[model samples]
Target: MKEKNQWSSKFGFIMASAGAAVGLGAIWKFPYITGMSGGGAFFILFIIFTLLIGLPLLISEYIIGRGAGAEAISAYKKLAPKTLWVWIGRFGVLGCFLLLSFYSVVGGWVVIYTGLSVSGNLLHASADYADIFDKVTGSAGITILGLLLFSLINVIVIALGVRNGIEKANKYMMPLLFLFFIILVIRSVTLSGAMEGLKFFLAPDFSKITRESLLYALGQSFFALAVGFSCLVTYSSYLKKDVSLPFSAGWVVSMNIFVSLLSGLAIFPVVFAYGYQPTEGPGLLFMVLPAAFSQIPLGGVFLSLFLLLFLFATLTSSFSLYEIIVAAFTANRFRSRKIVAWITGLIVFAAAIPAALSSSLLRDFKIFRKSVFDATDYLVSNLMLPIGCLLIAVFIIHKMDKALVREEFFLGGTAKASLFSLWRFLMTWIVPLTIVIVFLSMLGILK
Candidate 1:
């Protein structure tokens, strides 16, 4: 039998896992969604959900992967053999495939924008940034090329294997992402009328909290953490046994939330400073941000850096998505990781073309009253993730041996026995019930 790959260090594992968790959802979607959902109130609810639900589920995946010490599909099989429980892992693989299909589309946009920013194409544009955004996304050549390039980047990194590729890249990218955000925030908050944006983002308005927004917050928490998709399972499978699961989970969650808050701080202040409405939908980051950056001294330089940071975040997440599929197919020795990564990257790129063209050639394409891109996003975010999370909670609580779970939790002998019971109760009860309610509510069945 071939030896399994493991993380070289606990820090490497945390960085790689945190890289998976902190993606476009945190840096791009979170700010705009917060702006639209009434800022501080939605932000507060998102944090609450992260703590009460997302954190436990995160630790759940860690336990599942590290305990089983296998790929996502094999992990479940190892834990509960000769049963349908492995389908949870299969569901995760499918979910991740569908996820990256659209996710890469946005990632491609970031790649294209990064290029445009570097070449001064986006500088001092007097026209509406919305128009510029449309032109870029509407071009099939640009979009497809960008998607291919972005996918290629993912393939190259993952092909190097986990420790040297994923871990090393994350160690640098995560800190760079933070440093860039700090610079943007400093520049943004000093602008005239910036305090209003700060107020909007930090001051909770309870009236903004509605059923839909609450549901949105719940979903966003899950999305932001990259839970329910078994990406974490694959990453954690590479972890060493000496690593504390709870401590690792705490770092990922805290870093994710901090980056989210930083994103809001960096974006909203600039949006208000430029007198643009915060609720500009999906194009807020690509469109409104360039316009805001155009107003500052040496804005072009900062804009380029920001786009690079954005692309870094997207690529890190894409690495995890591709890693899950590649790891499963490779199965440690079936095919080389490089060969599998190339094949998988090609498939994902080809699959994502429709989504990439959704703004142009496939503009008229519709499924279930949504465009191809929107439909895929909805299916993954609204349906697949919640169901996957629910099943994982059930399996961990009911299928696994209590003694094994206790051993994994208390490996370092730091956490108390009472805390293990609390975790089990949350997984068995709170996590499942919350996911089901949110899933039903999203389906309009709860009202």
Candidate 2:
């Protein structure tokens, strides 16, 4: 049998895991959703869900991965041998495959936009920002090229193996991500009229909470943490036994939430300062951010930096998505990691092409009134993720041996017995029930 690859240090694992968690969801989606869902109230709800649901499930995946000390699918097979539970990991890989297909599409957007910003194409624009965005997304060739490049990047990094490739890249990228966001926040909050946006972002309005918003907050918590789908399971499989799973999970959760807060601080203040509406949905990052940057000094420079940061976040997350698949295929043959990574990257690139062109060539392609891109995203985020979370919660609580669970929790003496009891309760009861309720609400079965 071949030896398994492990992270060189606890820090490397944490950064890589946190890199997976902190992606475009934190930088782009969280702020916009918070704005649309009533700002501080939604933010508070998201944090609650993150703590109660996201954190527990995150630790659950960690336990499964490090406990099994194998790939995502094999983790389940190892834990619940001779059962159908391995399907959970298989579904996770499938979900991740579908996820990265469209995920890379948006990652491609960041890549293309970064190039535009660097080339001065985005500067001195007299046309509407929305029009610029439309032109960019409407160009099939550019979008496809960007998607291919993004996938190639993922392939190259993942091919290098975990400690040397994924971990090394994240160590630099994650810290730089934080630094860049801090700069943007300072610039944004200092802008004239920025206070209104900050107020709108930080002030809670409980009356604005709706069933739909509640569901969104739940989904966003899962999305933001990169929980569910066993992606974390793959990442954690590389962890050393001496490392504390609970501590690692806590940091990943904290870093993700902090980045989300930083993203809101960086974006909303600038949005208000620039007099743009905050409810611009997904376009807030692509459309509104460029316009806001245009008004600031060294706007082009800052825009380029922001795009680079965005690209890093996207690539880091893409690495995990691709890693999950690659890890599965290369489990028994470690030397084949490079070949598997290339093959996986090519497949994901091919799969994502339609989504890349969904705004143009595939514009009319619709499933339930959503374009191919939107439908793919909807299926993954709304349906697949919640279901994955539910299954993981149930499996961890019901299938795993109680002694094993206690051993995992008490391994490093980090978590107390009472805390383990609370975590188990949440995993067994609160987490599964909340996910089911959110899923049913998404299907309109409740209302």
Candidate 3:
């Protein structure tokens, strides 16, 4: 038997999931990637897929969790027979764990950057910021300290429980995040030569919209919206029965997509204004962003504030990831919630070791000549996410009662009914096929 939890309120659920969706992926990665992919064109494709493909999948996870009123593993078991569907739930949880393994390492970078920003170190090093980033990225000590700090923050939040835990943190953090983001975007757009970056970011060149670009857009949409993760399913288990899953999930995905687009607008103009290449990987934020900030008056202050906002975004998302694992333990027979939180945090800390040490001792322990971080990210993003989402689609459409799904999610009259068919078509055809092609492309088989 599982213990049931009711959400504190409607807004609580939205903020919590939105907090999950609005992570480092949005504030930094989205802008960097959009600029790299030819700006406005990629941004437009990303928005299109987010609504078409991401929204439906978001609703599916919410329905699964709310309708079943169970954790991800139990939800699937109750919703599907004992054949292979059970493994879907397991894989979903595994994906969450795998994600946190590297995500925490990145989360640590945010923490480090936040401290550096506050201390005025970021300003001094903007000239050759790549060298500074390389030093941090290469060090095992800094990474471990960062991972530990991230683990501590997430553990504290999860231990706080639902209303006080996830909801309260999001309610406060989300507003500050948006406020700072707006400020950063404004400051970034005002920089000299910023319009050139905005041109690349906002003015779409349709010629660049190749199949690969479209696929990348779709994948990023899903990941950025936090659609494929079982965290939504786990979080939704606490929802009140009367709540409209589709309406709520739509709002969450919408907000996240908006943030991603806004972030691209905020970042590209700055990147272009400064003549920075966007293909700088994880160092994009650390390296290029500093350069852009240096050219502004009181750039360090603004940059510090911006990175702090980025840190808050990453922390909120990391908190949700920890919540998913803790929910499983809390619902299952194990330690108490506090114990589960601590244990889960410790496990994540352990898993993050390889990625943290990737540039050091773990660099040589490579498969296919890639580091641990690369392997883990590739496996999760290319393989686990798509497979997990496919299982979710099958579970929702094939196994669960579509009529009940219609009643729960499609209750917004005729307009919603039309939307439901679009949702069905995308989940059934568009997303799955595109994921397959994207997976092949990532494996070098598409070329």
Q: What range of 10 consecutive residues in model 1 has the weakest lDDT sum?
A: 1-10
Estimate the Cα RMSD of every predicted model relative to the unseen true structure: 1.9, 2.0, 2.8
Candidates in order have lDDT scores of 0.85, 0.85, 0.77
User: Tens digits of per-residue lDDT for model 3 on 236-304?
Assistant: 887776667777877787789778867776677766666767656666777766776676678888788
Q: Write the per-residue lDDT of candidate 1 for residues 152-177, one digit (tens) a residue.
A: 89898888765677678788878988
| 1 against 3, candidate with superior lDDT | 1
Question: Which residue pairs show collisions in model 2?
Answer: none
Query: Candidate 1 clashing pairs?
Result: none
Model 3: residue 214 alpha-carbon error in angstroms: 4.1
Q: How close is candidate 3 to the true structure, as a TM-score?
A: 0.90
State every prediction's TM-score relative to the real structure.
Answer: 0.95, 0.94, 0.90
Query: Model 2, residue 134: displacement in angstroms?
Result: 1.4
lDDT of 2 by residue, 1-447 (tens): 233547888889889888898997798779878878898899999999999999999999998887888889999999999999999999999999999989999898888999989998886646477778888889999899889889888899888765777678788878988987887788788889999989988998899998778888988999999988999898877777777888888999999999999988888887887777888766677876786677768989988987887898888888888888988887777558888888898899999998999888989888899988878987887678888999999898889877877777777546787888889899988999888887677668888
